[model samples]
Structure formats: C-alpha cells, structure tokens
Target: MSGPAPIHVVVVGSGLAGYGVLRELRKLAPDATLTLVTADDGHFYSKPALSTALAKGKHADTLVTTPAAKMAAQLRLDLRAGRGVEALDAGERVLLTTGGPIPYDKLVLAMGADPVKVTIEGEGATRARPVNNLDDYRAFRENLPNGARVLVMGGGLVGSEFANDLSGAGYKAVVVDMLSHPLAQLVPQQVGDAIRDALAAQGVEWHLGRKVVSLDRADAATIATLDDGTRIEADAVLSAVGLRPHIWLARDAGLETARGIKVDATGRTSDPHIYAIGDCAEYPRGLAAYVTPIMAAARAIAPSALGTPTEIRFPPLSVQVKTTAYPVVLLPAPIGVKGGWRKVSDGSDGLKYLFEDETGRTRGYVLTGSLCEERMDMDRSLSAAEAEREAA
Candidate 1:
C-alpha cells in the first residue's frame, strides 16, 4: 500500500501564535507544506517589546525587520500577506480568504486579538489611537514629540506598562481608570499597590476610580473630560483598556465562541480537525493571553495536526508573564485558585507572595526582582502538590 499524501496545514494570522504553530509544525512534520495567511504586514518579532520600545530608545522599525516573505523563505513555506481569512468551511476543509479560497488538511486559528475601543465624546474622541500591531506602534512613535503629555485610558497591564515606560522616557503620562487600583483584577491588592507606587515614583500620574466621559481636540492639545466633569489636557491619548479576541471569522464560519474561539485543553476546537491557540483561543481550563501558554498550546496541537496520537494537558499554572523595566517579574495568581497570600520581603529589591489553600498547600505565587531566586524551587515543589495530595 502507498503511504498517505503529505498533509498541508493552513495557519491564519501571523502573530506569535501563528508563527509558533508554523515553527512547531516544521519541527514535527517536515514533509508537510504550510501556508501562513495574514491580514497585516507580517513582521516577525516579539510583541512584548512594544511596552519598552520608547524606554529602550528604539523606533518601531527597530522592533522587526524580517517580514513574512523572509520568514516564509527561511521556513520554506508559502506566506500570504494582506490576505485575511473570510471564513472557514470545516466540513469541506476550505479556507475562504479575501484573496481566494485555500484548501488545507488542517487549519489553525492564531488570529490573535484586537485592542478594545472606548466610547467617549469629543473631537479627539474621533481621533483617539490604539496600538495593536507594529504599524500602530510606529504611528505612536512618530507622533510622540519631546516631552509629549499623554493620557492613558486604562490601568490594566498594557495601560500601566505604557504609563511606566513613557514616563520613564521623559514623556508626561497620566493613567485614568475606573478601577480602584492599577492591575486590580489581574494582581492581588498588595501587588497592585507596589506597582502603583513604582509608577508614581517614575512621575506617572494616576486618576483611579474615574472614567472618561469625552474628549475634545484643542489647537495643539486634547482635552479629556471625566465622568465627574473634571477636565484634563494631554498631547495624545492612548486607549489600552483590554483586548477582544479576533473571532469574527470563526463566528461567521459557525464556530462556537466565548470571549474567544473556544477550544479544548490541547487546542482542539469544536470541530476536531480545526484548532485555535494564542490570544484567539479560550481553552477548556481558561484563557491565558500570554506567550508561555501559546507555546504550550502550539506544542500540544502540532502532534495532533500531524496524524500522531498524543494527549496533552496545560500545566495547572496559567498566567500572563510580564517583563517590565523596573525589572519586574510576575506569574499572576492562576484563575479559580482561591487562597490567601503571605508576603515576605527579602529586601528593597525583592518581595515574594505565596498563595496557599486552607490546607496550606502551595497553590500559586508572585515574586518580584530578587525574590525570583526561589522560583525554580517553588515551581518544583508546587508541581508536587498533586502527587503529594494523592499520596496523602
């Protein structure tokens, strides 16, 4: 009997997730032909660098040089740029795109996510900006003048980091968030306090517990009006509230979506032959919009895509890892791991917060700076929590 024909895989989106899937497919199935389709200019680089671009004294072009064409050449694959997927016909195994229809033995949705848009009134409101991709960052870099006054419209991870970075670079930054504290939902109260203090020390202003009602464009400045009728002025405004997964294609294709393209633990979507990963996927356990989980999802899905029999599960620990200039490191308390925290300060440079369940079993931890010295040992011991309980 003849061997089956080599499988052809189509990966949508050219972000980290899509690139990751393609890289893994190359590793696992060298014989397979892979096609990467992207809507934007497919530049290969780390998205995390956006946070520190200004502080690093770098321009957006410095972030990436190898475009999709070069990456495809290096990987020996077909790359379609500026071609967004229109829909997916799962039953027929066809991918409908703006350019044309493409067939694939397997499909991976790594479409990534879009930055959330805020609703406000005023002239500047119509001109408000958001940075979702390298192009957007380039625009931001070009528009920023020396000592430009900037108003960030959120206090979440993206917002806080932007504030810190821009402020450190000598740009006047003010963060406005309706939340009680910075990174309130993502971090514990104590961690949030430390982050707020750090940013404050860097000359970043905060308008906690306030919402923007509207924005008006002045001759050379933008005026932002708060809900309480307070007004503030800035040269530019950035909205980093949150991200919405790019799920319109999946939804139009009749795939299920909940905050994102719903997928199982191994990145398998509702349609077994189709898979999703990275910021676009909502895993069975939870959605983790970070590079680490994306790598895990890619590794798990690659084998399955290649007709290999394998089962994979995400590590119990899921989180958004951030590398900040303060030299900050954090593994956000995992979802649904209810517990209390005990903090120990090694010095001004390090602080460790341990989360334990009622039984005193280590469930999660957050370490900053030098405190991360204990990370390896803590991770090893925490991994034993399951075996330790089973043995008990």
Candidate 2:
C-alpha cells in the first residue's frame, strides 16, 4: 500500500535565489519533488556579470554557464521555462500559470526585482534602455553602433560599472546624476572623488549634480537636456537608477509587503507554507538585495520549506563594487544609527574610511584601490565589534 504522497516543492523564478534554495533543499531531502517555474528561459548565468561583460568582449549568449535542460537534468528538477504565473491561490496551494494550475505542498517566491524606469519627455526617450537581464543586454548591444556615445543615467553601483565597461569597450560613456559625486549613497565623498578621478583618466565623462530633464532626437543623434540647461548629444542612453522588488504577485495574493515581500527570520511570509528570498524578500531592517544575503537566506529557509524549521541570522556582509576603474568594498552602517565617518588613511595607492558610534564601537568601513585587499580583515573586526555590542 502506498504511504503519504511525496511532498512537492514549487519554486517561482530560476535566478540565483531560487536555485540556491533548490540546491540546499536537495542536499537535505534528495528524493523530495521539486519544480521550478520562470518567465524567461531557465538558463543559468551570473546576473552580476551583465554589467562587465562588454569590457571582457563577451556576448549575452556566451554569458550563460549552463543550459536549462542540462541544469534540470543535473538537479533533477521539473523545469517550466518561459511561463509566468498568472495568479496564485494560497488557500488551495496552487499556482495559476499559462500552462496550467500547479499544485504544491510548499511554495517559494524568488521572483527578483525590476529596474526602476525614469520618465522623460521626448521622441528619443524610448531609446533609453536598462540592462537588468540577459535579454536587455542583448538588445542594448544590438542597438549600439560601433564607437557609440552612450549617456548613462545615475551614479550608483550599476551605473558606475556600466560606465567603466562601456569606456573599456571603446565606447564613449558620459554619466549624469543629481548627486555631487558618483556612488554617493554607498561610499564617502573622498572615495567617490577618487573613483570619479580614476574613471575620468580612462576617458569617462562625469556630469554630476545634474539630472536628465528630457531626451529629444536631433538629426541622427539624441539630445539630452540637463537640469542646469546643459545639453549633450549621444547615440544611446542607459538608465541604471536602481531596482524595485517585484512583489506584486505576493501582494495581490494577500501577502504582506513593505519595500519587498515581508518575511520573518525564517523567510516565511504571512502564510506559513509560503516563503520568499532574494531581492524580493524584506526582512526586519530592509531588503538584503546582494548575493551573500540571498544565499544566506536560502540556506536558512531550505530546511523550513522541507518540514524542518530553521531561523536565519545574517552576519555583516561587505559589498564589493564592480567598478574596474577603481575597486571598492563597503560595509555600510545600519540605517538611522548614530555614527560618524573618519578617514583612516589616504595615500597614492588608495584610501580607507571607517565608521564608529559614540561609544567607540566600529560600525562600518570602506576600502578603495589597493587597500581593498584588507576587506576580510576589516570584516572580521566589524564582526568582533558586533559581538561585543551583543554581549554587553
């Protein structure tokens, strides 16, 4: 006589977060039924590599490390590619997709995030593109002519990386942002200045403290109007403003959402059987949108999804900025925490900055250029300080 039916775990999205869950779950329960559903082709590629591929002379197709079929065979997962979930019925434990309804014992949401689009007025406004995915990168490359002058909007991590990559690929890159310096949100002013100067030496133009007001087509080129009445002509524009979590599905399904899908320490949503991770999941402080946090969440949530409950405790994770012109590693202080930044060292090679609170507790740190090699050591120091705070 057959015993209880095999538990089927359905994971939405095939990106790093979803794949991480699948990998960990398999190790815990090798015979567990697993299915992966994604809107795009389920090929495996490093999402971070999209920003630097151009500099390395790599195409979108070549970026994929493993094909979908091969990954499915190796992982023993039921793969559903190029199919989006139309709706979700949490009460019935079913996902409504174009193919059909998929019944599952547990559901995992790792739908990722969407690029934030900036609205501008003009005929050439539609020409501005964002390279958030492989398909977007392919289209951007196809539309860009040789030696094209590309206008990059925003000065955050993604924007800085793209600007450097474009310049390295023999294309002219001009970055425009409303902030005074590049990566103002992530790094100190001095660090940002160093990066701006280094990238400038490599032929990248910086148009800081100005916003793109509009984009108008003039003859064969696109004219970008800045807030300060400055005009620049370019062949293409790329916007790397930021990313917003894709939480519409979860919110519409009656799940709680803040900046992202609200989840507990165990990655469990409002519904006990539903869990989320990656950029789409919001923990207590905020969304941990980086790779390390996602992997940590996946490891903590896998056992819980498989019936053995576990909780996640995220340690401090350093963000490694992918700007080839000037490498940077930053561990930002917690939001709203009272602290002040102090310059530790400034030399020809690079600079180092640290953040500490009133009680002499080290909260965060940033290292640039050759000094970035001290990342692991600084991370350990930060961890020790955190341990002391907790012990007290």
Candidate 3:
C-alpha cells in the first residue's frame, strides 16, 4: 500500500502574511506540500518600509529582500508566480487562475488590500499616485526631482510618515487633510499638535481641516485647490488616504465578507477548508492590516489548517507611528467603544495619553518622544485581549 499522501496547501499572495504562515508551517510539518501563487513577480519586500525607505536610500529595486524562486526553494514549495487568481470555487476546492485551475486540500487567501480611491477633480488629479506599493513608490521616486515639493493628501499615519521621510530626504513636503490635525484617525489633539510642531521643524507644511477638492496644472507645477479656496502648487502629488480590503474574491466564492474576508478566531474562513489572513482578512480582533496581528494570526492558522485546531490569540502589541522627529507608540481606541483620551504626561520629556472608557478602564494609550520607553508598562497593563481588540 502507498503511504498517506502529503497534505497539500495552496497559499495565494506573496506578501508577509503568506510567508509568515509558510515559515511556521514548514517547521511544523516538513512533509506537507506547499504551493505559493501570486499575481506579482513574488519578490519579497516589506510593505511598511515603503514610506520610510526614501530616507534610508532604499528604492523599489533594492527593497526586494528575496526573489520568489529563492523563497520557494527555501520553503520547499511550488512557486507559481505572475499568475492572478481569477475565481475560487469553494465546493470544488479549486482556484481558477490566469495559468489554469489549481486544486488543493487547503487554501490560504493572503491577497492584500488596495488603495482607497479619492475623488479629486481637475487636470492634475489623475497624476496623483497612491504610493501604496513598491511599483507606486518607484514611479513616485522617478518623477520626484531633487528637493521637490510634494503635496501629500491625507494626514493619517501613512501621509505623516511619508511627509517626515520626504523632509528627511532633503525634499519639501506639504500635507493636506480634512481633519483638524495630523494622525487624527487615532492620536489626541495635543499629540497631533506636538507632531505638527515636530514635522514643521523638519520643514513639513501643514494644511489641516481642509480637503484638496481639485488639482490643476500651473506651468510645469501641479496646483491643488483646497475646499476653502486655498491653492497650493507642488512638483508631484502623493496620496495616503486609506486602504480597503479585497473582498471580491471571497464574495465571489460565496465566502462571508464584511470590511474584509471574515475569519474565525483561528483565521479559518466560513468554509472550514479555506482560510484568510493578512490585510485581506477581518478576524475576531477586527481588521488586521499590520504586521503584529498578521504574524500572530499566521502562527495560529498554521496548526489549525493541519487538523490541529489552535485558538488564535495575540501577544502584547502596539502600533508605532514612524515620524522620527517625534516618535509615537499608540493603541488606537476600539471602534464603537465610548472612550476619551486623558493626558498622563506632557513636558520636555514628551507626551502620553491614556484612552479611558466610560467605566474608567484604560482601553488604549498613546506615548510619544521620551514617553515611548514606557511602552512595556503600557503593554503589560493593556491586556492582550484588549490590545488585540483595539490596536488593530
């Protein structure tokens, strides 16, 4: 009699989450057969590093840590590169791709999110690059002349970080956002002001509480008109508005999806044989688009996918704001949770704010500058459950 067939696992996507699970699963079950499929060339690179790479002198070409073939060889898996998964059939356990139909005992959807499109009218509007990936970064860098003035739309984490990076890289950065302050998605007003001051010192211009309603061309320059009738001209436009999870794949396959592909605590999708992880997945803790949660989910997902169900849980974690001028460690307040940020400390040492709920429970916290060292204390106090719930 022939030996039992090896467990065949097909992983879609070539990003961090895909590697995270594969790395773990390989160690656990070396005999398992793995197949990696992706739309890109499958060059391994860090997504978060794109914003900070300019200052570090790293471009798209240098950003790739490993090539796809090497990754497949290292992980001992079948590499299917430059193939887009067109459709998925849950009942048949098959995936329709650009190449052909591929069958697997288990499937992992790690296909990431896409840039949230923004509506801006006028001539230069189409010139804006969301800069969400290496390709966009490459194009942005090529178009950016030395000391170019970049108009960054959105004062959220990505925009603020890019502005900081551009400033550090000897370029002028002008930021615009409808919110009253930078990092308004999470940080308190005072913290935002501090960041504003820090970035201003680094030569970053701010246009808070205003939206770029349109973009026009002036001579060789791009002119951005704000909602309040304020016009600013720059060399290039970079968008950092937001990102939306890829749900069409899961939805087409009849898998449940919300803000993202819905997954249980163990990262298993509605279809028990199929699983979702990374930015594409909205798990029990919520939408995990960051590294920490994705890694954690990957750990639990590996064993569970192999017939050994593991309860996925998070380790102590906090998302760091990457403005080197004034660094920040923050746990964003949970959505639908009533809470208010209260100052814990602020002075020459830096700023700290604790997000407390109506019940006086510390739900989240933000620490900046010197106060960032206290991240461990904050991490310990913030239960892993609460941290997982809110930090994502």
Supply every candidate's count of residue pairs whose N, Cα or C atoms clash at under 3 angstroms.
0, 0, 0
lDDT of each: 0.81, 0.90, 0.90
lDDT of 1 by residue, 1-392 (tens): 98988899999988889998899899988888999998987889888878878888988878995766789987778888889777788889999989999999989999889888878987688657887789889998898889999999999888988898898789999999999888787656767777788788888888999999999989878999998888999998898989999888888888889889998767778887788989888887667788777887888889887777344544545343343544445556656777777775646876677777777766677777666666767766766766676589
**What TM-score number comes out for model 3?**
0.96
**lDDT (10s digit) by residue, model 2, range 209-271:** 999999999887899999889999999999999899999999999999988999998999999
Q: Give the TM-score of candidate 1.
A: 0.92
State every prediction's TM-score relative to the real structure. Answer: 0.92, 0.96, 0.96
Kindly report which residue pairs in candidate 1 clash with one another. none
Runs with alpha carbons beyond 4 Å of true place in candidate 2: none
How do these models rank on lDDT, best leading? Answer: 2, 3, 1
lDDT string, candidate 3, 210-326, tens digits: 999999988779999999999998999998998899889899999999999999988999999999999999887688678988898888999999989997887555898899998
